[model samples]
Target chain A: MNINLTPGPSQLFYTVPDHARHAFKEGITSISHRSKTFESYFQKATEGLKELLGIPTDYFIFFTGSATEVWEKSIQNLVENSSMHLVNGAFSNRYFEIAKQLGKHAQKMDAPLGQNFSSIPITNYGTELIAITQNETSTGVSLTNDFIREVREKNSEALIVVDAVSSMPYPALDYSQIDSVFFSVQKGFGMPAGLGVWAVNPRCIEKAESLLARGISIGSYHNLPTLLLNALKNQTTETPNVLGIYLLSCVVEDFLRIGIKKIRQETDYKAAILYQALRAHPLMSAFVKDESAQSKTVIVADCGEHSIRISNYLSEHGFNPGEGYGEKKKSQLRFANFPAHSKEQYERMVDLIENLR
Target chain B: MNINLTPGPSQLFYTVPDHARHAFKEGITSISHRSKTFESYFQKATEGLKELLGIPTDYFIFFTGSATEVWEKSIQNLVENSSMHLVNGAFSNRYFEIAKQLGKHAQKMDAPLGQNFSSIPITNYGTELIAITQNETSTGVSLTNDFIREVREKNSEALIVVDAVSSMPYPALDYSQIDSVFFSVQKGFGMPAGLGVWAVNPRCIEKAESLLARGISIGSYHNLPTLLLNALKNQTTETPNVLGIYLLSCVVEDFLRIGIKKIRQETDYKAAILYQALRAHPLMSAFVKDESAQSKTVIVADCGEHSIRISNYLSEHGFNPGEGYGEKKKSQLRFANFPAHSKEQYERMVDLIENLR
Candidate 1:
């Protein structure tokens, strides 16, 4: 048996194959998107997500192709001229670039690799949107809840969009502090890649409508108004990833049954074990030196020149650790500690790291 | 045990369950998108599609959220100002609406519902694109290949775009005459929804680049150039529906093994039998008056006020025929003749329709 330790598209929860089998047996894959069955499935998913994430009553949930698409969609719908981004890694930087590519005046405050902002930056850039990635999968650096709250305090007028791509459920985010949060199911949700879930409060919706009323092209189909119109009827603007949505509902149900508090406890335990092992290892060290800034979901280690050998050792023993993102591909080994990844699996991983010579 | 005759999200091919089981067993769902395994899957799907569809070397294939999305992408990338649409049904009308929604000058030549154009319109409106739907799923009307060829002849300078959503592979389109063609996997391809395949020739690419150089927002992340840049490396712009892509490759392989010619032959035979039965029935008649223009893929019948009764009878007996789209819901019934629907199934459906009181 093989274990997937990559950040996104990580290991599937133990119940996934069985759920998929049930879905197929019920003709879930062959049903029409306009059917009552699909509507029930959509309802279950949206409600389950709201229950599990503690999403506000005023927030609306929408699905897109990927979290990357949300980067474009959020900018298109919310920002008419300018946006501000706080960048600490590759994924955050991509959001900034998307804003710029759409002809928005995008300004960014950056932090060095393996480090996170010590405090929220005060800016007078006249930005309409403020983008933040809660967890940087590239460097395994995450912002604390207090940091996000501070940012919100400083920029109360600008819409705050959070990228919770690799750090969700475990983050314990107060949704009341942000305007929008988006994540792909492949990451912490431990499902297949393809579906992006975006939760936005009424403020974002009002912004989109205001822009549309002013003759700014927010987008065409699948834009905020279109998605909202269909969503009110428990449908989508187009034929969405029905199977992905169904599976996500099932997974979220499982997570809720297990309880989020217990999941967070398990996550903290796993992160402590893995980080301790990395710090004590002879040839490896934790990439993020500040313990408070390091991500609990995606743990990265600075392997220096032994990245390949260490990854090979883990793979040979049935663990498939992910390489660093972009330029750090050869210098770091990243391990995902998603809800689907058991504590026993983390122990096995730590054993391998401890025995590495 | 149920027969799915609804146009899209219709029926899963018999091999799909077994293929999905194999996918689960092989851990295909948990693999990373950046891994070599994913690249191989991408390569296989693209190559399998090319071989099965006889797509030319100059045409580039890209995947999107849905065919509805391609309607927007094609217009965004290929047209700068104006587009002319040949509208006969709901799907065709939707394309024209999308173009108008994107702030383009969209013009249309309309035909009454359940009717098709007798001749291509002569236009010198300086249209940048001419859009046509080979098979309109909503009205069950299809344009002949001769009609498409005639349109190409009338407007040589305008890019020809075809929506082959419900009629792919069976139509055996001559790609040399068209600049771009797009389809969703749920219809003729007999897979789950959420994947849109867009194949564009080099001319379409050049058009997109020219628009981009002129500072048009053709889109940001999933724009043509960004998609092409990743396609060159056997990847997508974002974390795509990986399982959907894998399943499509498998289905295309199945088609190649059985041969497209044989599939087309079976489709023709089944359509003939169904249409004959509808013509002979006392309570039902063919919806499209013109025999030459009726679609072989989606066969529609005017059941008058007995539409629900016939559909109910079929559903109670294990077949689920589709209701008419939009305004025709009370008067018509639609049946799909995809590769997944066997000759035996079609015969069974015909027998039921003929004996209905």
Candidate 2:
């Protein structure tokens, strides 16, 4: 009965079928990784993901442990000596941490919190890779498609990697120009957490191959090349989240039933209504500076004088508004509208916020 | 009705409770990585893993994509020098490949096909770590506790990692002497395969810390330190298999009720029933060279002349035995027995095999 407003693990709109439930009950735990039944599910999920996301036919999608893992994987496989990072929020800043940890040469172009890199000025930083967060969930800011294309052109040789953790499927980006795109399933995909999805271009694959061909050994599990080989066959070299795979397959099927365009439009309207409600509230104001850059799926707002009190009030009223994600923890709250959310639910959420105001 | 004896992705014996299912349905997917709920689950899973395994209080456990992921994590995080591998079957052999891929020196004491590791005499030639499979599911061979303890005492300085994927929760190993133990939940735990649990000793933590202190970035997702910190706080840095976590919790509760000791005894009896049937069958013979080394959880056997034909026949009659894993393809079948299995089910499987024979 809890209204899950916390970003990432947002609400799922569908129930998993009884057949899948029955499959979980009887011990089928010993089946090997390459088993036919598992392969079927794996094949379906990979194809479903590609189709749902409109990933280029040449680009292959694979699942990993988390986007955090993909962050490291992208660096290990793609970055030769140096990479450029556009840091706008918490999740964005973590990419530099991952790059530095992997002993890669990484330079950061950081922006203040609640601000986004709508356009990164052309920089001759001598970097082979440029990583940016498409949607900064912590600050509720987004980098639009035009911005991404500009950044890609800014450093043509620098393979672009987009951390689309919070933006995908709603504040949707055209990933044609990017070399690699990373996001976790729990957030935008509307499935349970723990599965990270990545779309890798041929250039990224070449980078991975070069790393392996040379003696620069990237760690297993996170290695994109190894994962790609297995993923192509609709199987992972490691044990995958079997139930998550099943649930994700169901979620994808649901997504197909309600076309992506419909889902996107519905989500956009939901975001507009929620934003209108928040802006009308006397005690709250939007967190992001630019309206264009503001995330359509999540709203970051600074609660007036009694942010904590208001958040608690909303929670008490059975609507859970999430605590701030970044530096403005006490003052800001995040409200996310996942796909399949109803207008009535947003209105009710607004009603709870208004009562608190 | 399918007897998924294909190793992992194997048959799940227990049923998931309504609470777990309800949590899964009611937005277990919606909780963000930053949320207190996910953090609670993470911390509880770590603690629960330790408690269930009777691991020492000083030990820390981290979850990963799979045991295969750990192979890379260990190589990346712990192996500064060469590693010694004890290869009895398919899974064990892969470590050598992983080690080579990671640019680490590796020495292997390989057993012949259908054989167990008889001796792994450690040499001081850059062997900082020694890896072994406690139970070789491919060959149904198990390394005895006495042998493991002897090897550990002999090479006290060397980090010992045991892949106990197929032998955990039954015929349990003492975690005190082992530095790191990796097992997927699917095999002996009677859960799905996506979750890999590692019980790491203080030495392993020290190794990780030392590596981090030395600025050896062990990638983000595979970074055990980050995983432990978040796990200790009851949260994962990424989305976790929340349904799998809930199911594991339920399964663990059931195990606690039945008692691991009682469960082991029950598994032993069930295995004996199958083993007895294997001996009685004229067409079948145990794959493992030594009966003492045979796995109590899985029984691997070779059909006299037509392995696939026999497997197909038995499968048609509602008994699905596991095929040989990896390069040790075809010609062999395996039977898996765990705590959740019933004597009646074991008898039925045995009868099917007998009738088919």
| Top-scoring candidate (TM-score) | 1
Model 1 chain A: lowest-lDDT 10 consecutive positions? A118-127
Docking class of 2: medium
The Cα error of candidate 2 at residue A97, in Å, is 0.5
RMSD vs true structure, all candidates:
1.1, 2.4
Q: Write the per-residue lDDT of candidate 1 for residues B249-311, one digit (tens) a residue.
A: 899999999998999999999999999998899999999979999999999999999999999
Per-residue CA lDDT of model 2 for B1-357, tens digit only, reads 656665665667556445456766666656665666666666666666666778788887777767778888887777776898988887888877788777788888888777665644544434788998988877888888877887788788889999888888776677767888888888777676677777787788788788788876666655778877876776666666666666666677777777777887888888888888878888887777577788998888877457889888877867677776655457777778776567777888788777764
The CAPRI quality class of candidate 1 comes to high
**Which DockQ value does candidate 1 get?**
0.83
Question: DockQ, in order, for the candidates?
Answer: 0.83, 0.65
lDDT per residue for candidate 2 within A114-138, as digits (tens), equals 7776444655566888988888878
